[model samples]
Target: AILNSCEYGEGWATDTYEKALKDDAEYLTTEQQAMIKAQHALLKADHDKVKSMHDTLAEIA
Candidate 1:
């Protein structure tokens, strides 16, 4: 269940990021892509950690 939730969150983030990029494609540059990539990675990692914590709590209970 935790894994599923994490995957869903990641997918949502990816879709949102892609949409934003498409919306601003005319103004986005290579540097912007790099910045977005970094931000995306950070978000993904944070989501994963939160999911993991939930899983651990469920295991304890």
Candidate 2:
């Protein structure tokens, strides 16, 4: 609750960064939205690869 209620002072993480950090955002900063989407895609790909490897190892075991 403290983080959510924090005031936006500057672009610094210790300030407004908490509020800037949101979820399921369709438009984040407008400029960084595309980059954020790309980052999410990379995360999903990495997660899928890890999951697949785990499943394969489980089957082997």
Off by over 4 Å in 1: 1-15, 18-27
Cα deviation at 50, candidate 1, in Å, is: 0.4
Error of 1 at 30 (Å): 0.4
- Tens-digit lDDT track for model 1 on 1-61? 7666876787689677777666876688989977887787787787677777777877998
Measured by TM-score, how close is model 1 to the native structure? 0.60
lDDT of 1: 0.77
- What residue pairs are clashing in model 1? none
Q: Candidate 2 residues 1-61, lDDT tens each?
A: 2222222211132323333336435546776766665655565555556556656766897
Task: State which candidate has the highest lDDT.
Answer: 1
lDDT of each: 0.77, 0.47
